[model samples]
Target chain A: MASFKQIHKEFVAALLVPSAPIPKGLVALKKPNITSRFAVYRNNVIVGLIAALKSNFPICFALVGDEFFKALAVDFIRKNPPTSPMLFEYGDEFAFFISQYSPADQLPYLADIARLEIMWRNAYHAIDAKPLDIAKIQQIDAKEHSNLTFKTHPSAAILKSNWPIYSIWQGHEDNDMVDIDLEVKQAILICRPNVDVLIANIDPAACIFYSAIMNGRTLGNAYEKAIKQDQNFDFNYCFGQLFALGLITDIAAEN
Target chain B: MSNFRLKKIPNLAGVGLKAQHYKTILQEKPKLGWFEVHPENYMGAGGPPHKYLTAIRELYPISLHGVGMSLGGPSERLDPEHLRLFKALKDRYEPWLISEHLAWSTHEGKFFNDLLPLPYTEETLNHLANHVDEMQSYMGKQVLIENPSAYLAYESSPYAETEFLDQLVKRTGCGLLLDVNNIFVSANNQGYDAYDYLDAYPVEHVEEIHLGGHSVELIEDDDLGIGKLLIDDHSSAVIDDVWDIYKKLIAKTGPKPSLIEWDGDIPEWPVLFNEAKIADGFMKKHVSTKVKS
Candidate 1:
């Protein structure tokens, strides 16, 4: 007789690994056919997990087609089942898995696309915060602004990749861009200032500054890093773009 | 305990509130008893789920059905984090009724999100009862434990499924949610008396009823195409057999709050709304029959 703990371990093992036989002592003695019946449980588990991934990564699903995507998702699920019940946070590691996935290597840019989708989901579900009043930033004296530190929106993220992921993302939205220039590098600033999630293409300098503030660095230090990344980095232009997007929710200045 | 007596739900039928149907539900204001949502769907930070749910909730009563609680987890401790999320949703919505499956979806720090059946044994019964008791207490309200649609029965199980549920009721003072579709599907797959399972059920304590669709698949290479298995895929309209069983249960137990659940391949608003109306029609017919008798 299997203990509850033992049975669950075996059952989960059997569920994830399709080739593994059903857990011992799980067969119905009265019923003649148990394997096919057991397969139903496997089908339900795999199908349900696949559906979650499919919804999360529609672009990936479309690019790979349904059959290939299901197979890919099944492999990922077998390796990494969810730790928490909240499914919105379930696929955070999927993009990482896709990057390392051996079979998906042919389409090198597929993993970055998955990353963008995950970022969109994160922004969609992040804590709602009121964007800082623009008037306050407008009134900041020249010297005071230099030492100021700002807190980025709870859901703000910067995804920098060598592939043109934004164009790939746009192609999926029915505005099909026939030819994607994959050689060019791209960086997207993801934020949900209001109801709709917003994404803006930014330069490497802006990515450097965004990463600095997200790491709780002072504006003065972030500007130094941004300038180091790009000699032509315009603090005013980058700041203006971020302010317009409502990516910065709060700020503090050392008087 | 909000009275162990069943909570009085409107004697009308309802449907699972899906996001696609939100706009039309608010615009048309479909005649629904109450709309149910999986609390997990609303757990997101902000946006449309709140916007439309707020509008629709005002017009119709709401019920919270949970899919990820892991009530009967192998570990003694209930997942505190999930409970916290659940508590927040309950405080916000104040749904008419909240229910979770009797089975566990999480174990050993991993979750499957599918309702996995349990062996009917004394150890399993006691563990589940304690979990339910703790859950109801933590929620500051009683919860109805829904019986799962079983795929395979354990031969080593000492107690019958009904007896195990009855024990939980006796020990923890929780209510039951009878999924009629589940009953039919499980009976057909496991080769049991569907009505007999219902007869042995604690129907008096059944606070709610659920009706959904299922598909039949023939098992291969077993006694030369000897058996058929029914999968409870809630994607299609309610089948005739499930309707017959639901009507029989309604006739026996009288009218209760029923929900038309079309989880997958959800049809347009009118079709799903009509299914709810059909359920309501059955309830009205049962009432008229009682008056004639």
Candidate 2:
């Protein structure tokens, strides 16, 4: 009799790698057709996992065509099986895997694109929060603004990329034919003001400021960092832009 | 609210609610007896999933159908994180039923993301029953154990699948979800008689049922040349053969709260509702007539 742990381990191993040896007690219906039944399970498991990944990373699939994406997915699944039962969270390490994947090394920006897609998925499913009311912020005194620590909204994502990922993503959207340029760097911000996801280009200074806020920096310190990066960093314009996008939700007193 | 505490779900048909049809269903308030959701989808802290679920719960009964519990495993241990989230959702939604698959999903701490089958044996049954008992104790309510749509069977199983399920329910006092499509798929895959399996099932313990579509694939075999394999893809329309079997099972078991599951490539809301309506019409015609006579 196989222990529960041994049986489960063997079952999963058989499902993951079809060629893995089945446990001692497991039987073949006839003489030498040992791998027959296990092959069915192995196909189902791999196909299901790949389908889940494709659903979660549709944009990633679009970037890399289906054949290449599926091949990469098979390797990725074998290397990094899911840590959690929640399928929505199964591909957390996919971007990291893509980074080290040698076959995909020709597309240096593929990993970052995967990261962007993951962020979009995260923002889509993040906890819902009411964006800061513009009228409420206007009610506060201008003098107290520097002392206030602004908290970013739950649906806010700030990303910086050396490739024109926004164009690549948008081109894929309408099935538009556009040549990919290898020399463009883009900083993008994605926010959910209401229900629709809105993506926009952001300046490097504002990206730094938002990134700082995302990392728990005080508003004044983030502003200082933003200005240090770019001498002509428009604090008022960037602040208004962030507020308009509903990225700032909570405000705390700077200690 | 009525004081009637249902020991078993009434034999009425229901629909699996999707986000695309949330507003339409809520606004129209269709005469659905119940709704089922995959608990993992709503495991987040606060979001639209919960919001829509809250609104829907006020109108109809709900069932938290879990897909990731890995109930049929070697160890009798339940995932604490999954349990906590499920408990929280149950508390907030106050669903009428909770259920999970009779299959394992994880091994060595790595989730395979599919409901892998288990060999039916005394050891596996004991392990699964204890897990079911633990889950019921933690949730403070009985759960329905649904039969999985398996693609293959292990050659080393000592007990029949139905017998394993019977032992599980006997030990844990848990009910059965009795997915008829799954029975069809598994029977076809394993070259067993689906009708005989259904007839032998402990129908009294069944509280709910599931009906879904499956896709067939032809695999080459050395001796058999090509063999037909039924895959429970849940991506297309329900087949006539499965529906016929479902009607026969319903006739025998009486009306149970059944659900029409179309998970992948889900069609327009009306198409799914029409399918539900078909099942609803059958239940009303058969079960209600039996009650009246």
Candidate 3:
């Protein structure tokens, strides 16, 4: 006489843990043997969640190959079953998980690759907004340019990584054979300025500047932060890229 | 709430819309009765999924078949966040038919992503009926609940699957989406006659029908009485035995809107489209034969 709650608790417990025995009260029609039958659900739960994870982190899957990815993904799925029902939102913590996973320490950059993929996915589905045209910025008085604050597009994001993640991601995207320099620190700007998601490599200085503006810093303050990182940081280059990519949706001059 | 008009999807064969097929569907505008999508897929704020869905919605009718509602969950109530997102999709798309499974996918705030089975008991019935009622009340329209494909049965269950569903419908005033392949798969796995399950089903309340393919695996132990277990993978074409059951169902229910759902190992657009045509042929043949009678 298991209560519904008790039965469901047992059911879900076994579902997440592959080695757990079948919960009590489950029966098959023909014979008492329900092991294989129950195993179907265990397989479905694990396999289905693994599939969702695979779709979410395709680059991570590609880097590790199928076997390692499946094993790693299974561990991740069992440990961190999705809190949300939306499959697309399932693996937000996967990048963080990969960073701590010991087996993947050999490929230290794999976690950052997962992060870039997540960023691309987020950009793909981010809230749509009209990109601010250059004409809008041209109207801003030169004296007010440095004092102007910018509103980043909803989909815009900056990722700075110790590994050459942009090159690895680009190689996968273009299906090209490129010798990635592992020592090179890389930063990328990810956004959906229009219909398609765009991911471009950005200078480290620009990453700091973009991060500052995205954090609601004024142009002067963002530029100051960028120059602090690199004495030769080019403000015009950073501002040109932002305006060309339409990453800024609105700008407000300080009163 | 009163002015909401649930668009009527034509009673013809449709295909489960996949993202890969979106471009082809928009370009070809194939003569599909309607397109069906899992509302969870479109829950994102805005993107290609929405862009293509919007374009296709203009040319063809759409139905939202939810896979993550957790309507029969053990929790006290349905997930409010999921409900809000689903409601937004329904408002934006205005799908002709909205449906979810009788099984639960969430427990203790973790989503399993599979339509896990529930036991059939008076308490279970009451719980499911309340969930359904809440969904309908919030939706301002009836949602057809689909029967889940099962592999194992609960020993403590008191009622048959169909009887439980009938009770849920009677209490909640919701409709049913009969997935014929689920019947074949569940019956074969659970040792019940597919035709018998169909016979016991409350077909009068069925508003739409689903047709899909399943994968079969042979169990190692013959003494278990279950020689082959059918998995409703929906990765291939509908088999003849399932079609026979579907024909039998349509003969009784008379040409409900059926969909050819190939969710896994999806083939080329034409291959999936051809499967829908096959279903359309069955619906037409059954209807004409009934007209003759």
Candidate achieving the largest TM-score: 3
Give a tens-digit lDDT track for model 1, residues B1-293.
Answer: 11122323586898999989988888898777888889888788776677677777778777788999887778887888888888787777677888999888887889897888788888888898888988899988778888888777776789887878888889998888889999988887777889999889888888889999888888753444566788888999999888999999999889988999899998999999999998999999999999999
CAPRI-style docking class of model 3 based on DockQ: medium
Ranking by lDDT: 3, 1, 2
Clashing pairs in 1: none
Itemize residue pairs with steric clashes in candidate 2: A4-B74, B11-B255, B11-B256
TM-score of chain A, every prediction, order shown? 0.87, 0.86, 0.93
Segments of candidate 3 deviating more than 4 angstroms: A140-143, B1-6, B222-226
Best by lDDT: 3
My TM-score estimates for the predictions, one after another, are 0.91, 0.91, 0.96
| Top-scoring candidate (DockQ) | 3
A162-233 per-residue lDDT for model 2 (tens digits)? 888787777777787378677888888888755666677777888898888777777788899999999999
Displacement of residue A35 (Cα, Å) in model 2 is 3.8
Worst 10 residues of 3 chain B by lDDT: B1-10
In candidate 3, residue A79 scores what lDDT?
Answer: 85
DockQ of each: 0.51, 0.43, 0.73
Off by over 4 Å in 1: A24-30, A133-149, A175-177, A212-237, B1-9, B221-224
CA lDDT, every prediction? 0.83, 0.80, 0.88
